[model samples]
Target: MDLIADILLAAGALGAGIYCLVLGRRLNRFNDLEKGVGGAVAVLSAQVDDLTKTLSSAQNTAAGSAQTLTDLTQRAEEMSRKLEFQMASLHDIPDTPAREATATPAAPVSAQTTSEPMFVRHRAAEAHQ
Candidate 1:
C-alpha cells in the first residue's frame, strides 16, 4: 500500500509542473502582444499629426489664392470703367483738329449746298425732318 501511494504522489507532482509551464508560456505571449499593440499605436499617432499639418497648410494656401483672385477682379473692373470713359471722350476729338487748321473766313453756302446726298439710307434726315 505504501508503494502505490508514493507512485500517485509522484504523478500529481509531474502534472502540476507541466501546468505551470504552460501558464508561463501563455503569459509571455500575452506580454508580447501588448508590446506590438503599443508600437502600432505610436506609429499611427505620428501619421495623424503629419496629416493635420498638411491640411492646415492647404487651407491657408487656398485662402490666399482666393483673396488674390478677388483683388485682380476688382482691378480688372476698374480698368474696364476707365476704358469706357476714354472711349466716350474719343467721340469729341474729330472736330478739334479742324478748328485748329482753318483760319480763313469764307461766305456761308446756301442751304441746298449744305444738304448733300445720303451716303447710306438717310436715317439722320428722316428722324430729324
Candidate 2:
C-alpha cells in the first residue's frame, strides 16, 4: 500500500512540473516584444502620442480661423453700416437742380428745323437766341 501511494505522488509531481513548463513558454510568447501583446501595446502607445499632437495642432488652427472670421465679420458689419448711412444721405438730395426751378419753360422744337435726333449742350443759351 505504501509503495502504491509513493508512485501516485511522483506521477502528480511530474504532471505539475510539465504544466508549469508549458505555462512559462506561453507566458513568454504573450509578452514577446516583437510578435505578441507587448508589441501591440507599444504600437498603440505610439499612435496615441501622434494623434494627440495632431489634435492639438488642429485645435490651434481652428482657433486662429475663428479669430479671423470674427474680424472679417466685424469689418463687413461696419461696411454695411456705412452703406446704410450713405443710402440715408442719398434721400436728402433733390431730384431736380435749383437752376431748373428758376428757369422759364422753353419753346417746343418743331421737326421742320431739325431732321434726325440730336443732343445740344447749353440748350438754355440756344433757346434765348
State the lDDT of candidate 2 residue by residue for 27-124, as single tens digits.
99998989999989999999999999999999999999999999999999999999999999989875667788469554464853677657658888
Name the best candidate (by TM-score). Answer: 2
Report the poorest 10 consecutive residues by lDDT, candidate 2: 104-113
Tens digits of lDDT, candidate 1, 6-110: 999999999999999998887666556347554566778889999999999999999999999999999999999999999999996645366554765443546
Q: What C-alpha lDDT do the candidate models reach, one value each?
A: 0.80, 0.90
Instruction: Give candidate 2 misplaced runs (Cα > 4 Å).
Output: 1-3, 96-129
- lDDT value for model 1: 0.80
- Residue 101 of candidate 2: its Cα lDDT? 46
Candidate 2 residue pairs in clash (backbone atoms < 3 Å): none
